[model samples]
Target: MKVLPSIQSPRDLRLIKKEHLPTLCEELRRTIIETASKNGGHLGSSLGAVEIITALHYVFNTPEDKIVFDTGHQAYAHKLLTGRQKAFGTIRTKNGLSGFPKRCESEYDTFGVGHASTAISAALGMAIARDQKKEKSKVIAVVGDGCLTGGMAYEALQNAGLLRSDLLVILNDNQMFISKRVGALGKALTKLLTTKYVQLAEEKATNFLKRFDELGNNAAKLAKRARSILFPGTLFEEMGFRYFGPVNGNDINEMIEVLENLKDVKGPVMLHVVTKKGKGYKPAEEKPTKFHGIGIFDVDTGDTIGKSNSVTFTQAFSDALLKLAEKDKSITAITAAMPEGTGLDAFRDKFPARYFDVGIAEEHAATFAAGLAAGGSKPVVALYSTFAQRCYDQIVHDICLQNLPVVFALDRAGLVGEDGPTHHGVFDLSFLRDIPNLILAAPADENEMQHMLKTAFDANAPFVLRYPRGAGFGVKMDDAPQNLEIGKGVWLKKGKDINILAIGNRVHPALKAAQALAEKGVDCGVANMRFARPLDTGLIDEALTLSPRLVTTEDNMLAGGFGSAVAEYLTDKQADFKLLRLGIGDEFVEHGKVSQLYDQLGMSAGQMTDHILKWKTK
Candidate 1:
């Protein structure tokens, strides 16, 4: 009899014997590992969080008692327990189970989360709402220690302290956050675990309380005060939270006991629980970061199944930066805790002094790079396109305002598959194009990306290079990188019937569409409009001379995007060309394979050809 398939909900889980809970936890881990191995996801974090999620569901009267998860990647167990077990295999697939917690999906998920350090703030709000409504519901926030590196977590903690509401914040310290922990906060947390005296005191206190039946009821309070006397949870204590535990979060029994004891405690409480990143799976435990967010893998060997031999845009950027930095000693790199993901780990290893991992602080990374550029060092801040949204103000005020020479290398700047709307880089063109003193360029392939990187440094202003995720077109590479002429567009093929102007990753697709159209007797031309900021007016003029109809394509949003820039230019000039824009529409794109999404959006070569033919007939 399998404990997992039988257990449909937390209500069913509550009926099971306390001793049998560990068996259920094991079953949950097996299910999570098996499902994640088949359909790629946030494996290590979800695996480590199995016991914690199981304990929370078992101890709390959920559906009423709210449990908010920071960086919802760790909520796989929660989803399974909340009657989503049947559809768990379809995670991250289009129209299937979402990778993260979604409010529309289930009643058990009190808050929808994808980003980090937001749980505490969201939980505090819920707790306040419950109090005002006179509802007897407990609100708990399960936050990873990696999320603590972000300033928003501190801001929420301070606000929660001021509110003095009945809220519980469980700090899930796995000693890792995507990569190894950085900064003084991680050091402080590690120091808390190493206090020999505190460990002994905790043991003696537990033993002493267990012996006294009447005193055992006050065990949590007494232990908290006793621990406070020694090293203490001074950080949380000062923030007006009753600090409890450096509890073993991986142990199901220990977690349940601690959570049960602290359920009714008054005011704000912080329970520090330590767990391993990849608790059960051996491969993930050894290299948690690689498994943090991964693709399909072999379960037996713990190896990725379908890795491409061609270099990705991220790799191209990394290789280009490494070559550029060898001669330019003033060149430095910065990342907001995504060194490995952005391919800056090599740069970090080679130029340790020039590399800075600013943890999960995107705003800080942008401003810090601006400061570096202001002081004579040329800094390149590499970040995921979605994460870069957090530093819009910094880009505008700190870097662009001063006209500093900071290169913003934004990776995954398009329809990023599997991660869904929360991780898509589709809005970069719309948001970044309006900023003054910033040169925005998108590459058509890996070869162009290197030249754009070289161009960015030479421009000596706030420069942005946005590229899509995954492998680029395996075009022949230049022996050495060369700076491209800023705001210049190159015509790949000329046409008489219609001309297609495309930017970034969409250029090759547009060219393919043009080729297909030419076979159908429609003379179509294609041009790679490299810069989104400075529209290539000369290219547009040349296209207009060839044909009155022009089609603009991009991997960004249709509104206020590359096509919008072309439309704005044509409108200003009173041009007589009929314009058609092709890109993502005004909707959040769901998670799916990149090919499936492009085809569905009518951006694939065949689809684009069909769309253009239909429009031309119209």
Candidate 2:
């Protein structure tokens, strides 16, 4: 009889024999690995957190007692235990189970989480709410060590400490945040691991003294004090949390014991649980970063299945930056704990001294880059478009206000498939374009991407280069990157009926749409508008002169986006033309294949062609 198959809920999990819990953890790990191998979701962190999650569910009465996950990367086991086992394989797919913990998905998921460093704050709110309602349920926040690097976590910690609420915070220290952990906090956590012998001695001493009853309680207190002197959780203790453990989070028995003891602790308590990033799987253990957020892979060999041959926008950015940094010694690279994801790993390897991984602090990364630029180095802060939203104020006040020559390489600036709304980079154009002293450019292809990168560096101002996720159009690479003129666009095709103004990755699709429309005797002109901030007024004028009907397309949201910019320009000029804006609407786009999302949003070639035909007839 399979232990996992029988577990429909945490209620069922709690009924399992204590001796059989480890077997259940093994089954959970196996299930996660199998599901993730096919679905291509977060594997390493989820694998590492299996025991911790299982222990939490087994110890606590969830649905009533809340367990909030920080980023949801480690919530696969939680999901399985919370009656999502059968739907687990459908994670990260369209109309399927969400990869992250979602409140709407189940009552067990107390809070919907996608971004990091939010769980502690959310859990604190729940604890306060529970108090207000006069309920006696436990609230726990499972925050990873990587998320600790973010300033938001510290802010929550200090506030939680001040409030002195009834809260249980489990610091899941795997020494990773997507990539390898960095900074002083990581060093502090590593230092805690060195006191394993002391932890063992304290555990033994406490157990041995229990025979003396009241004296044993005092002796246990003495042991805890002695242990605390050596324990790194002194930092958390100082923050008003009753710190517990350096406990083995991988051991199901140990985790359950620790959780059982800490669950009823008064005031704010933080348990520092240490687990390996890739505990069970050999391949993930070998390369945790690679397996962190991997594609569909061969379960037998741990190799990626159906890997693309074409160069990705990330790869293109990485290659171009490498080339640029070779000649320009002043060029420095920065990432907010996303060196590998943002293609800054190559730059970090090549220029170790110049590279900086700020660790999940996007706001700091922006300001730090600004400071570097002010101090006479041309710094490029590479970040995911979604993460970049966290640093809008930093970008405006620190970089743009000062007119600092800082380049922002905003990758995955459009629909980032599978990661869904929280991860999608769709809002960059709308939010970023209005800022003064900022030049926002989006490349239509890999070739254009290189030039835009070069253009950004040469501009000597706050420049943003936004590009879509996944493989770029297999256009031939230029021999050398050239700095193209700012605020200029090129016409790909000119037609009699309507002009299609497209930007970034949508240009190729717009061209295809034009071709399809042409077959139906509906003539359409296409122009690649390179920059979003500086609207190509001349291009727009030319397009309008050719035909009154103008269709604007982008991978960004239609509201206050590229189309809005064009519309703003046209309305300001009092130009009479039929405007059909083709892009994502006011709703959040969900996780799916990029192609499927594009079709659903009416941004794909076929969909765009059909939309144009319908609008033209209208």
lDDT agreement with native, every candidate: 0.90, 0.89
- For model 2, name the residue pairs that clash: none
- Looking at model 1, report the run of 10 residues with the lowest lDDT sum: 176-185
Scored by lDDT, model 1 comes in at 0.90
Against the true structure, whose lDDT is highest? 1
C-alpha RMSD for every candidate: 6.0, 5.5
lDDT of 1 at 90: 95
Model 1 root-mean-square deviation: 6.0
